[model samples]
Target: MSNAYTSPIPIKRTNLGHALASEWTKIKSVRSTVWTLSIFLILVIGIGLLAVANTQSDDYQDVPFTVPAFFGLMLGQICLITLGVLVTSSEYGTGMIRTTFTASPQRHRVLAAKALIFFAIAFVASAGSILLVGLMASGAHSGPEAGDIAWGGTVVKGGLYVSLLGVLALAVGSMLRHSAGAITTMLGVVLVPAILPGFLGIWESTQKLGEKMGDYNAINSLAAIFQIDGPDSSTGSSQLVLLIVITAAAVVGAFALLEKRDV
Candidate 1:
């Protein structure tokens, strides 16, 4: 009698592409994604419609041009942040993070894949919200020419800005590892600076500091990507400098901690 031996097939490690696919599937399957996106649509589209309906100007002349669209942008950004938090924090919530790390040892790859997925989701939602608002606004007007849909660099950049903010939120969730903590911190990032602006205004000594700093607060900084006459529009170079510095610090810090910390 002869003995026969067989070798088992080699298992391949999950690559970034596979990781992205897996993460995308998990994201789409979650009930949370649907809820977040639904609420986002309601607030953005609902508010946008209201803004157009209640416009002080009955004619197209009454519209602020960008006000209807901007209103939706502002509200849609919140949903982006929520989705961002979920992308990473949910793994921690369900204790699946350990498995994720086991499957993909490179933390950078995990975060990178997550951010990419989140950006794609956010961009689609944000862009769609903008387009819907623009359409609603156009329908509300009955002039010789329909209100032009401003698909300018400003609008495109604005969409990108919202997507990046989602990426930022995901990084925060990864760093904090707790949903409550990540959300609270993000709200602080959105609101605290504005609260201090008034105090700075009152204090003559710090007036300039507050004026220059407060006018370009966090939200404004992000919102500038969309504004034709944003807070820093007068000096394009200055706006670019501020945007680069703020965004770089945030993304770099997230990457650093993600690389060094234990999952």
Candidate 2:
């Protein structure tokens, strides 16, 4: 008999699929994921129904049936943002990232996996909730007067927009490596531009700058996607393009930092 021995177990090279599976497991197994998503569902669905119930048939004349969903999403997105930060920052807090990095030596792959998985979850949840609300609203208020209710457009664009925001939060989390700090940074990113414009408007010299910022802030971007009137003439496509550019830049920065930084 030969002295060499081989084990019966088989091994395969790891790839993005393996990383994705691992991330999926981690995300699903966490309590924070469950809680945050639960709250998001409640806020989106509950508030949407309430808004619809309070409205008259005339309310749908100008706005799409899905407009009510926007109100709930405005608050629900905070939950997604919080969840996004926790996805990465939680691991760092508990020192679990070391093991994750060891299991997947390619840091970029791990981050990519996280981003893909998170985006899928966020998009599905957001779109589903919006669709449910839209259907309810349409059923309750659809009539000849409700002209051109673009609920379908709202569902697709609204979902994509919210999902990108979550991914951006993930990038911020990865770069910051702290939960509270990353969440705060994202909140500021969302709110500061919107609020700053109001303050800037008080001064004549900065009024134009304020108008420019207000036109492009997160609130206006979201409102435009929902087919609501905003301060500026920015179309949904323009706002989405701007968001995509910002998110891509943040993701690139996260990848670069992950490569250079020690675990």
Best by TM-score: 2
**Model 1: per-residue lDDT, tens digit, 64-137?**
24446666666677787888998999899999989988878888888888888878887787767766776666
Superposition error at 132 for model 2 (Å): 0.7
The clash count for each model shown is 0, 0
TM-score of each: 0.82, 0.95
lDDT of 2 by residue, 1-263 (tens): 67877878898999999999999999999999999999999999999999999998887777888889999988998999999999999999999999999989999999999999999999999999999999999999888866655569789888899889999999999999999999999999999998999899999999999987887787888888887763233348788889999999999999999999999
lDDT for position 138 in model 2: 90
Show where candidate 2 strays beyond 4 Å: 1-5, 230-234
Candidate-wise lDDT, in order: 0.71, 0.91
Q: How well does candidate 2 match the true structure in TM-score terms? A: 0.95
Alpha carbon lDDT at 231, candidate 1: 31
Q: In model 2, state the lDDT of residue 76.
A: 90
Error of 2 at 238 (Å): 1.2
